[model samples]
Target: MLTKQDIVAVVVLYNPNKKVYDNILKYKGLVNRLILVDNSLTNNKYLFKNIDFVDYIPLYNNYGIAYALNLGIKNSTEKYILTMDQDSAISANLINSYLKFLNVNDNNGIGALTCQYNTDRNPAVAKKGYVKVRQSMQSGTLFKRSTFDKIGYFDDKLFIDVVDLEFFLRMKRSELSLVRINAAVLNHHPAETKVKKILFLKLKYGQSSEVRNYYKARNLFWVAKRYNSLDMYKGLTISWLKIILLYDDKRKYLKAFNQGIKDAKHNRLGKYYSNYEGN
Candidate 1:
């Protein structure tokens, strides 16, 4: 069993809401240290300046999750790092479980441990105590800090979406263990838009805005191109098509999709903004 001091919790903030602050309170005794990497454009950085048991680093811009996470990891001095989103909450015993699992798998080349979460596409492996999966989200994951040296940090070029998948694919290729616990600690669905079931076809996961759509499509395309996997290629085709067909304002969504494809083709990345014309 691992003690609290052995783990460090890092939360990436980008225009987070009130829940984030409330959750920060819960993290106080959960781990020995708490780090908040603020990427908000506004003056939200002031909120963390003198907080007890917290170290705040404000980027003052939307640098995306990957950058903030890398910053947090660099600042951490613990054996294990627990990465969390502003709105993420996990099982109370999550740390204990991770400690147990890692203790058992320390000599088995385990790089990280991910937890079960609510998702549109549920997998059967989640029903088991532990499942060796190729993909796991960044949030609700506990990582062995040394693994960063083995598998390079996240690609800053991808920016946001598919960032976790890219890292997962790389880990899978490296033969590193990426296991997901059956207990669903991090049950979060930030995207509250209702899923539109289309005439007996696949369900459309409603998106928040055009900006998000662009990142989603572009990053997926970029990953698919590099990985050259049939599932990714098929996902790339099907996902954007659903985004276009299911959105209320089809023209704006289609435009974002096209722009994403164009940017990916030209190797353009980092923060890109739209006029919010149709928003």
Candidate 2:
């Protein structure tokens, strides 16, 4: 149904490795243009300069995912935009399946479409057909360009964590649909995570650094407060507690959590201005 000419892919990179080039090759041919938004502290243009049909834009600083995505989206003129992470890759068939779904369904009402990600943290769930979801991760997701004109771009204040959730809330309020193609799969490499056996259950604990924990906690609280979703806020709070209890670095995480709560209550959003670094 949809051709390569109608799609543009944007891959956000942050200190990406050589393997990212191979990942780009997987879906580059499926789109008309591939925009690489590098959010690394240093330039990584040399890695993609030789590649064809790729527009590499390096922001010599860590501008965060929301800013990077907005930059890429603003430069593209394609009908559909595929937002991806450097560590994510999708098959050609998956692209065709998404286009086919768009052709058969009411494309106007669809705000965004995402595939079931096959990740190391949790394996993909095999299912037939598609289903509506509350929200989806930014990686391996296809968005309608017009959706932005209707609902506005992602909140730049969010920076990284929970940016997707904040955008989904706006989409929901606008009555735009977010769907997932169950059969289509995106192979994603997750961050460092380990399985820890706590009591009777083996929990997969995320090994995010202290800096990331701050952003996660702060953004989650702010987003929950902004949207007034009590259940969502409660669930995320409980999850964070479980991780702090079962994982190492309890004091650091607890401090970050408290700071995040204080910041959210004061409505202080944007980059963290603390001694800790790295996202």
Pick the TM-score winner.
Answer: 2
Q: Which stretches of candidate 2 lie over 4 Å from their true place?
A: 273-279
For model 1, name the residue pairs that clash: none
TM-score of 1: 0.88
What TM-score, over all chains together, does every model reach? Answer: 0.88, 0.93
Q: Count clashes in each candidate, considering only residues at least 3 apart in sequence or on different chains.
A: 0, 0
Model 1, runs deviating above 4 Å: 119-128, 197-204, 274-279
Model 1 scores what on Cα lDDT? 0.77
The candidate scoring highest on lDDT is 2
Query: TM-score of predicted model 2?
Result: 0.93
Q: lDDT tens digits, residues 55-94, model 2?
A: 9999998888999999999999999988888887767866
- lDDT string for model 1 (141-235, tens) is 98888778789887888878888888888887787888887754665565655667667876636466777778877888878888886656776
